[model samples]
Target: MVYLAEFVGTAILTLLGCGVVAGVALARSKALAGGWIVVTFGWGMAVTMAVYVAGTTSGAHINPAVTLGLASIGEFDWALVPGYIGAQLVGAFFGACLVYLAYLSHWKITEDPDAKLSVFSTIPAVRNPVANLTTEIIGTAMLLLGILGIGANSGAVSAGQADLANLFTNGLAPLLIGLLVFAIGLSLGGPTGYAINPARDLGPRVAHALLPIAGKGPSDWGYSWIPIVGPVIGGVLGAWIWNLTGFGS
Candidate 1:
């Protein structure tokens, strides 16, 4: 059931998050070219909604990095990490598919293949591997750190207790998390588009490769590993730092 919640929550996150990109980038949409601020706010709200819906069941670790980071900090069981990540990936795939369906006709109208691809995954403004990887790592580290701070403040998930109600309802962690993501997107997203969550990037990128969208370009498989590897590294580092600091003790 917890796995199911993670899946559903991640799916919702991808659906709304990618959906905004589609609306802003796709042709004939009212939100076309709405700009970065709109995309950032949309993703932030997406995270909030997903957390509200799934926090009670799965602690709302919709992002793989979040799951891994918590495990590293002893907030979550390491044994369950695989299931959580798998569910998150599957959910993100379905969510991206839904976005494709929602914008069924727009693909043909949109001339830029890169734009279509952008809806599914992050694209760096400058494609330097080292720099891109560094940006992702830093952004994701910030994400995990912020999440740990939020959890500590809320007492939502103590050493052994994972109380969903306290996390979302009592502590308002969902709203704060949304704002955190919003801030990240606004401040640090320019480099690698701030793909702090591996599942958030890879699942949708896979969907983009499999789905039949008109004039769709390459899935950019060559650059896919950075978002996954960098975030995992960042998450672990963030959790390790938190533990060292005794912040969540």
Candidate 2:
């Protein structure tokens, strides 16, 4: 069931993700392109569906950053992180592959290197190292903060019991979590579209690198590391902040 959920979730994420690209890039006639809003909402909706489908069993952690952060807080088992990350990556890879297949016909019509690169992975909107790094850090931090809020340690409720009634009946927690992500995207996603999930960013990035296509542009290997490192650092910071404040306490 976990594997199935991961597959479906990952596929859904990629479908919406790459679909947005196709819509904005190819559907724009010849040289036109879609803007940031399409990408931001594309990912936001991807996450929403991914979590709604797999949240109960696998915690819907379809990102390495999420798995790592959850394990650090002891909310997730360390033994499971490797498997979760691995599964997430595999799922993302296949999902991106499917997207590529779906868009192959349209891909033949476009000549923009940026548009081609975007169909599989991310690229900086305003290429500045410090700014991009900071954007990723803040974006991932917001995501982690939302997760910590949603899945924080329940020990503070009682020695061995939690107030299930209030926690479940009141939808405050889940709403806050979703809004956190929306807020981050709305505020900080302008620069790089906020690749807060390492797997989400890297797996598709790999697909972009490996896939064969005519007139494809160069893979931006030099800046690829920023998404991975920035998210990890921001996730840690977000988790630390949540732990320190005891917001979910």
Top candidate, metric lDDT: 1
Q: Cα deviation in Å at residue 229, candidate 2?
A: 0.7
Per-residue lDDT, model 2, residue 25, is 76
User: Which candidate has the highest TM-score of all?
Assistant: 1
Each candidate: RMSD = 3.7, 4.2
lDDT by residue (tens digit), candidate 1, 119-224:
9999999999999999988888899889888877774445555556454554588999999999999999998888899999999999999998989999999999
lDDT of 2: 0.73
Model 2 Cα lDDT, one tens digit per residue, 1-249: 776676667667776776676667763444245566766666667677677767666667777777787678776788977778778888887888888887777777777777777877768889988889888988888888877665654323343555664453233443445456667777887798778877777778788888886577887988888888898888878877887797877
Q: After superposition, how far is residue 221 of candidate 2 from its true place, in Å?
A: 0.9
**Superposed Cα RMSD, model 1:** 3.7
